[model samples]
Target chain A: MEKWRATSNLRRSLKSILNRQLSSVSEFRYLNEKRSCQSSFNLIRDCKSLGQVNAIQHRCFSSASTLVQRNPSFSTLNSDDISYFKGLLGEKSVIQDEDRLETVNTDWMHKYKGSSKLLLLPRSTEEVAQILRYCNSRCLAVVPQGGNTGLVGGSVPVFDEVIVNVSSMKNIISFDKVSGILVCEAGCILENLISFLDNQGFIMPLDLGAKGSCQIGGNVSTNAGGLRLVRYGSLHENVLGLEAVLANGDVLDMLGTLRKDNTGYDLKHLFIGSEGSLGIVTKVSILTPPKLSSVNIAFLACNDYSSCQKLLMEAKRKLGEILSAFEFLDTEAMNLVLHQFDGVRNPLPASMHNFYILIETTGSDESYNRYLY
Target chain B: MEKWRATSNLRRSLKSILNRQLSSVSEFRYLNEKRSCQSSFNLIRDCKSLGQVNAIQHRCFSSASTLVQRNPSFSTLNSDDISYFKGLLGEKSVIQDEDRLETVNTDWMHKYKGSSKLLLLPRSTEEVAQILRYCNSRCLAVVPQGGNTGLVGGSVPVFDEVIVNVSSMKNIISFDKVSGILVCEAGCILENLISFLDNQGFIMPLDLGAKGSCQIGGNVSTNAGGLRLVRYGSLHENVLGLEAVLANGDVLDMLGTLRKDNTGYDLKHLFIGSEGSLGIVTKVSILTPPKLSSVNIAFLACNDYSSCQKLLMEAKRKLGEILSAFEFLDTEAMNLVLHQFDGVRNPLPASMHNFYILIETTGSDESYNRYLY
Candidate 1:
């Protein structure tokens, strides 16, 4: 609980800082056009320090509304609806407390916030279906949330929509070792799935910075492409099938373990990247690759972008399939990372070049990969 | 023309024979229940020989209607529409010749055949847009076709929908050698693009058996997954952007060259595997990987299925990154391949095993990969 409070406070502070910075930049642009260069210089010299800017910026925008207006098409939460939800989900599953609701209403970036009065935690697909059906009938808008770690502001609501959180629905249905197919509930955390696959001598095809908080269902829903996409491809190719509940509470089950099935229109692809607009993804069936034995990482510096590009081509030509990742960062980006994070040193000399490239190779022959490098 | 005729004849004969075999099996099932065991044996004995089966089967199903019924909602070809098409695209572009229309109406597998009277070949994206806009206003159903190599009957029209073929639009717009981003018209043949990339020291991320005939548009539209998918991944990840024409003839240009863009909802994904339903893909921007220097293919035999599964896990463990392809075939499949093609002998001794696995590894160092194998 204490950790959660700290995280919440950090997120709010970051959001406030960013909001203030954006407003200040816009005001500066407006003022610069009316004032002369000398006057602008004087204004900058007279302004308060960086710490004071936050307070002043906050005061300037506090009188104006920042919250998104609730959609009139959606019904506001009432006592009867809350009672019905509690009766169906039990009082413990229904969250109405203001403090608890704050976390569910805000996104990870703390950029988008909603005033949703109710947050329902359904433990099963059937319960999700029931909730959606009732919400549909009552003309209530709903935001189907997984871990709510989405960067695109997709997981949160724009208004006071009912939040149907699926964190309690985490479950690993089944796994076929021979086929490397994993069937799991939508709310299963990515890192947990990765750990489970690791035990089975396999690995999830995707790796992301938010793996700890992101859920498999949300990954599939958003068609999240990450670090391993260059090697394992996107979710559309790795996901064998999935089960989703439509707007009217109709369950569209296209889940199958077959690697190749050309039955019909492949309706599953529609819901894969729909981001919960078309349906609420209940479960996912994915293909995990076998875990490799040998892995190596190398960091190199390049004098220019062209040299980096040439190096990538050379790596592809020489390394072929063993080259797992070839990520590059500009000098400015590297400096920012070094400045922001403590105890993180550059693999290459800081004065070496303007760009740094990180290459990872995984193969059965560690000696061969090392020799090639 | 001669090769085309021979290929067309072979495809039709194969389809006819398969259709007859299906009907015969159904009839045999019904007759076996009513007839005595001896009679059933005698009937089998009295049937035509293996060589004669093809001829007999062809005659059995030839008279049946093999064409799909035309959709009532789509208007049939009229003189005015043909005249307008000919006026916009020259008369030579409007293919009304019976011999040519036969190939356009039929799919590669000869499984589906449409009865459209005209086929319009557009040479440019603007031409395609104009044709679709005219067709939309006229309420004429249009089937946007590429190489017509799709097995799912997606490239071919189901009924008399006007076939607006894009084979004439094959053009490589531009390719940035540094970025490895290739911008080309949708009609470019897969093999042509492969050859072009090979010259630039790059390779298409996807490969298929129909590389010689399949077009980039068809491959992207169907989201074709082939052998190289185990290494390079599907089109969704490789296709950076695309230009499509909507049902209303609105040109939706999302052809971006950036590797990372989080501007808005990625609308290009909707058209990636849509099978040309939502829109007609006119152009594509794809990221091509650099060609590798070393490649090795090995064939190994395993005594049992368990051994084969274990070998796969071991390969993944041992050859962590260099493992490009791991394919297995049973003895029956091997025998069939051997029997179907002359001079194609099994890599391993025939007496060795019942299951064969093909392993391909690629890396920068040929010696290292060879030593590891």
Candidate 2:
């Protein structure tokens, strides 16, 4: 226990020292803006300090700036950066309203609060890339915001960083009916994408409860795993290719639709679930799934957990790959669901078992039903 | 275009020089056992040669390897290192059968060739960790191999390094029937797991075409995607917890059945699809599903790509989430399956359209099937 405590302390201390050193460097760069370009690269080059170096060596680590950067508190960006952004966006996109900023700073969870002085809303990937390039050159930190529906404080500023809101960039660039691939802007809402695909008779392979407000960009950032994970899968599987602007503003155009591309290391994955710490994803290309005609949902009450297991095995054997959902509603979860939701009823009596599985099976016709019956 | 060409040429030159330096260092390490404890981590630290330095710089410049580890050839370990590994294993389960090694090296596509000088098969996760610690201290690169049915060359050694074959480590540790979480060794075959679950009346939520030969470790290391990914999802989604040994021999024990864990960076994913460059996974905890009773399979021929896509969308609207498999088979893939496999008939006429779809609808009994059909 003593050794473990020491190890934890050492790790934290090292992290603090590294953050201090980084913040000092950032401050130095900000003060001497002329050398900011050269200094930013140096900081990236020395990132090993943040990841590897032990903290026990440095005693005065409390003053170190965290990896998350902040703009001067209570101060907005200079007219130069704002005008530069406005010049690229041609005016209507950037949001400077404090009320809107407050809303954007606090996400759906209401957990994280940001201090970003200004928020730039870009309408296109090119504009986004340009903005990032400008920010990188000036050694400015950026917070990439999507639908503002994130849970883990991602998509919101951790510090007083500039928020590059991609909400205005929502547009379905292209759709390949054959491959079921959808190419769209990063800010495209999940709900909109699903509806559009539904209208066209296709469906995005993945869905979640947050689909109503969550942006595809935010989803990709957290590699969002929701209920359909039992069926359609997570964002990592659905997202095919991404167009992201790196920290250095280099546009990584990994927009290929080929399922098998082993040209090099998969860079896109690093940004996925990175929470915009590494880069700003501007556009996304994802593999959508074909739609189904119907579904059959059964809320089953099992005698025991073993019975539930048996039930799944039987379904798999009889159903093959058609079983879409096999959700276990623990007794506690079931009680909570009943307590929280209106019009939702428990299918099984409380005294039956400790677990109740909500089994939902989907298919086109009566063949599946025959086996179940 | 000129700038791009120039950059590409510089990259190519840098790559060749780095490759040569690594090759020579590996050769030197092989000749002298004392130098065998080298890892990719050391390559970044002790690189004084221009070639080695340039390679490291190239990695830094790319923003590619910065997110992930650069690919390391398997020639870092020596024969003495293998002996040391044997000492760590206590000599009981190690296997060096050339025929077995040769078969295991070749993947499903026959693309990877394993040429390891030694093959150590550990029977338990503890043994695996011990061997890794010993090897890591000696700077030895250990290639982790299982039922090597990978589409990519992730399971095979890149050079003449020691191979830690996990075949002997197969065993079921524990299972929670209530939570539907199962813990097993990395070497457990997917089919065996399915069978075990079947006997118990539950099913592994995930399934793949390579279930017969592919081990869970291989599936995890490759983040394997399969047919059921359209439903139960890829290995990454189904995977709940893992026991992995890092490069430096530290064991990260994240074995649990918690649906929600916000502890820290999801370390499991870092090793998943890392191709054994980062660590070797020894055990896995996964969420299985309760069995379902039935499914409906449909083989449909569409007029065109758009029509096929439209058909899927219509089905999803009609079926909701019950549509499990909407496999879009390219004409080429369909023809290949039909020609190569017996009992696999073409669902559509070859000359009629550009593509064919095998859509399966899964659900409960006949009553539900009637509604779907």
Candidate 3:
């Protein structure tokens, strides 16, 4: 236990140091004027510091309230509705506390705020279905929340909509090592799955900066193109099966672990990337690739966009299957990261290049990857 | 010109030699009782020799005629329909020849045969759209054919239905070397695309025995999981974008080559693996991996299924990313292959094993791959 604790502490420290060095080099966002689209909504968006998000949100979205008016069709949440939810899913599962409401009612950037009075935490798909059924009959508007790390105001409640967070539904159902397929509940955090797979000699096909908080269900819902996308494709590719719940409380069990199913329409993909508007994803069956022993990251500087493109082509041609990621950021984004975030020492501090590229490669042989580099 | 011809000749000769040596070891089929399921329907299936298919199919499916009854809601082909098709897509495009119809009507296994009297070859998506519009208006049942290499009689028409073959639509559209994205008409033969990508320093993610004859459209429509599925994933992963013509002649243009796009429903996946039931895939934009220089195949003898599973798990772990294919067949299947195919030689001729396992590895570093082996 002592040895495990020491190793865990060392690994965490290493990860923190690594994040400081490379978190700024997340997936490219083409220099957004407002905030560089800091940390994507998907599972694998480039990592952004929470401090940076806070700093920007405070200055922006002062007129967030004027964006949209509340719909009259949505019935007001009353004491009776709250009582019904508490009866269905225990009183503790239903939240009316302002402090907790404040956290769930707001977006990751704290830009989009809502006046939602209730938040429901369902531990199972059945509970979620029951809650939805009640809400549907009452004509109450509801919003499904995951990790709440989205930048585009997707996770936040727009008005007085009740928030249904799946954080309580986290559990790994089954794992097939022969096939490297994992079945996990919706609320399982991305980092948790990654670590679990890491111990099992496998790795999740997706990864991102928000992995520490982002749920796998949220990743599937948003169809996140994460850090591993340059190599592993997308959620549409890695997700083998999905179990989602429709607004009317129907559990759309499209979940099948088979990789070679062509029996009928692959309806599971419809819920993927639909952002929980179609259904709240309850479970996910994803194809995880085996973890490679050797991984290397190369930091490169390019003079221009054309040079970056050229370099990308060369890297693809040379790196082949081992290439896991090819992420880039402009000099302006780099300057912002350095100025806003503390302890993010620039890799290329001597002279600022027009563009910066971060390339990652993973393989079985440490020596071979090093030699190729 | 002479030097180029010599190089081409050498490549052809080498490929033929390689195919002859490895074609028998395509994929695992668990000692298929009737015919070993010869090859898969999708883009990636175990490649079976033409001789093996003919030998088994001649004996099997003797009662295939009585399987599916034609729906009475469909109209029979008439002279007016023929004239209309000829007017829209030339006289040569409308094929009534028994010789050609006989070939297209029969599946690769020769098990299921259709009685379609007319076969229409459309040159473009527009032409296909027009043909479908006319057919829909007339209530004529039409079956789309691509390569006619699908197992289980999918490509074959039933009960005098119009056969719309997309062979004439074969055309390479655009290829982004940096992105390694290839956009091509569905009728482009799988072998042709493989060769094209080979020249462009890339490779199609899917491969099967029928690659020489199978069309990309058919591959996408059936969602073929070919030899490389163990490494590159299914058509769901590699197919970045798709264009399909719905049953009512409406064009579903869901084609977008961008790796990350989460705007709305990813409807393209519904078309994939739907087996042309939903729509006919006209064009495909697929993600091709960069061509690796070194490829090695290992043939092993296993005593039991348990051992095979163990080996597969080990290969996934030890071999990691380089492991492309892991196919196995029992001694009975091997005996059938040896008895059926004339020129094929057994890799393990000294003594019979309970099972034979074949693994393929691809990598950029030749020496590294060799060392790992």
Q: Scoring model 1 with DockQ, what do you get?
A: 0.15
- How far off is residue A311 in model 2, in Å? 11
The local lDDT score (0 to 100) that residue B192 gets in candidate 3 is 99
**How close to the true structure is residue B93 of candidate 2, measured as C-alpha lDDT?**
57
Q: Local error of candidate 3 at A106, Å?
A: 0.5
Candidate numbers, best TM-score first, in rank order: 3, 1, 2
lDDT of 3 by residue, B78-120 (tens): 8898889989999899999999889988888977666889999
Off by over 4 Å in 3: A1-67, B1-67
The worst-scoring run of ten residues by lDDT in candidate 1 chain B lies at B41-50
- Model 1 lDDT per residue over B166-226, tens place: 8998999999987789999999999999999999988898888999989998888788887
**Model 2, total clashes:** 35
Supply candidate 2's per-residue lDDT for A66: 42
Ranking by lDDT: 3, 1, 2
- Report the C-alpha lDDT of model 3 over A145-184, residue by residue, as the tens digit: 9999988777777668788999999999999989899999
Q: Which candidate is the best by TM-score?
A: 3
Q: For each candidate, give its TM-score against the true structure.
A: 0.77, 0.66, 0.82
**TM-score per model for chain B alone?**
0.80, 0.77, 0.81
lDDT of 2 by residue, B173-289 (tens): 988775578999999999999999987767776678889988988778777766666556566557877877655555667664555342222445545665554457889998776
lDDT of 1 by residue, A1-373 (tens): 3433332333233233223222322233232333322121112211211112333346555521232223334456789899999989999999989998999888888865767788999988888888877876776777888999987567766567788888898899999987789999999999999999999989999999999999999998888888886567678778988887655565666677877553323446646765675568999999898887678989999898889988987776677666778888998899899999999998775565789999987665666668778
